[model samples]
Target: GAGVSQSPSNKVTEKGKDVELRCDPISGHTALYWYRQSLGQGLEFLIYFQGNSAPDKSGLPSDRFSAERTGGSVSTLTIQRTQQEDSAVYLCASSHGGTDYGYTFGSGTRLTVV
Candidate 1:
């Protein structure tokens, strides 16, 4: 991909259902991140994955939320047992290096839990 791309631009799921959001980042990028933005709120970091390193999961809101990057390229963010509070725009970004580098962000997936 030339830039970061996210799937399912909009998703509507029943409460308690699970959803998987995917992100395909630009080729050769080594760092990927997952974040969510609630209505009128700033972006909240959820997870970070760097090339072949253990991911940083500390920012995840709860155990139900988890993300993984496969082969240091495509990444998936899974939310199990979705709640109303989980409704938001989920964004993914990637960078050539780690946190120090500038990032390219995707359009984001809008998730609505009904």
Candidate 2:
């Protein structure tokens, strides 16, 4: 049972730069979500993907932010033109998208935009 995984758990970048955060969801799960948590704040949904199609991108902060999933398992969030306010923990979760299943989250990619 492979769980979710993320790379570069800690990331530091300069303003106006581009950064990519990766996520590996559990096998057999069809639903994946990306959420961002700011300091002392609650989690904010960024995007959601079911299988290979994304039905929700409304949560993405701006056009500068985007994400994609391949093979219905791995996902990557790309931040274009990073800003200081973008510094936060980006969390990835996957589940069966049913009443009984719970989302499993990765440790998260902490982005520090300076």
Candidate 3:
């Protein structure tokens, strides 16, 4: 892809249901990130993966939130037993490697837990 791509642009699920959001980063990019925005709130970093190093999952709100990157290209964010409070736009971004460069972000997947 020329830029970051995310799947299922929008999703609506009942509370307690699980949902999966996907992201495909630009070719040759070495860094990927997942973020969430609730309504008017600012973006919240959920996780980050850099090259072959261990992923930083410090920002995940709870054990129900998890993510994985396969082959360093495609990534997935899974939320188990969704809660209404989890409703937000999930964003994915990729960068060449560092904060020195701006990131290319996906349009985001809007997840709504009813």
Candidate 4:
């Protein structure tokens, strides 16, 4: 895809269920990021994967939240034991290795845990 592509633009899951969000970044991008924005709140960083380096998981709210980038192109975010508080728009962005070219964002996946 020319732009970042996200699957299941919207998702509704029961509490305690697990969900996986997928992101396919533009070809050649070396940096991928996951973030979430709750109602009326600013974006909260979740995780970051750069090149071949180990992912930065510091921003993950809990141990149940994790993400992985496969072959440096596609990424997936998994949330185990979803909670109502986890409902938010999960956004994916990709950059060309640094802040120089900025980032290309995908239409986020809106996850609603009920």
* Cα displacement (Å) at residue 102, model 3: 1.9
Top-lDDT structure, candidate number: 3
Instruction: Please give, for residues 1-114, the per-residue lDDT of candidate 2 as tens digits.
Output: 478899879999999999999999988888999999999999999999986564599999899998889878788999999999999999999998656368999999999999
How does candidate 1 score on lDDT?
0.94
- In candidate 3, stretches whose alpha carbon ends up further than 4 angstroms from where it belongs are 98-100
Pairs with backbone N, CA or C atoms under 3 Å apart (clashes), candidate 1: none
Provide the overall lDDT of each model, using Cα atoms, as 2-decimal numbers. Answer: 0.94, 0.91, 0.95, 0.94
How many pairs of residues in model 4 come into backbone collision?
A: 0
lDDT of 2: 0.91
| Candidate 1 Cα deviation (angstroms), residue 19 | 0.3
Cα RMSD to native, each candidate?
Answer: 1.3, 1.3, 1.2, 1.0
User: What are the per-residue Cα lDDT tens digits for candidate 4 across 1-114?
Assistant: 799999889999999999999999999899999999999999999999999999989999999998888898999999999999999999999999766668899999999999
Could you tell me the lDDT of residue 69 within candidate 4?
89
Q: What is the lDDT of residue 51 in candidate 2?
A: 68
